[model samples]
Target: MNFLDHPFNARAGDIIEVSLDKQANVRLLDEHNFSRFQRGASYRGHAEHARQSPVRLRVPGT
Candidate 1:
């Protein structure tokens, strides 16, 4: 639903600065730590769950 061919109100190839939960399905724009996001990606600085996941699942999908 979010994968945009053409994002509304958002221009294509625009560098949209954003922060997200650790479970968000996204790839980092950097090169060092390369990992694929299945459910979603998270903001490393903001995602406490990424450091230590909850006993139960906190990720929305899985």
Candidate 2:
């Protein structure tokens, strides 16, 4: 029931940003905030029904 666990709240085509750190896990990234996921932690059940999220762009003119 947490923020990241609620896939219904996360819309497709939404902006998702991942850390540049080499050890970062895409699924571990927080969808409702700017933070990294903890090790061995799992997302809520909603993740299974979640839509395909795309990464947001920070490039110039974007």
Q: Which structure among the candidates has the greatest lDDT?
A: 2
For model 1, residues 1-62, the per-residue Cα lDDT tens digits are 45312122333343444344444443222222222222355333112223322222222221
Off by over 4 Å in 1: 1-8, 27-62
Candidate 1 pairs with clashing backbones: 21-42, 22-42, 23-40, 24-40, 24-41, 25-40, 25-41
Compose the digit string of candidate 2's lDDT tens values, residues 3-59: 333232334444445334233223423443333233334443112222333434222
Worst 10 residues of 1 by lDDT: 53-62
Best by TM-score: 2
How does candidate 2 score on lDDT? 0.33
lDDT of 2 at 57: 28
TM-score of each: 0.21, 0.24
| Clashes in predicted model 2 | 0
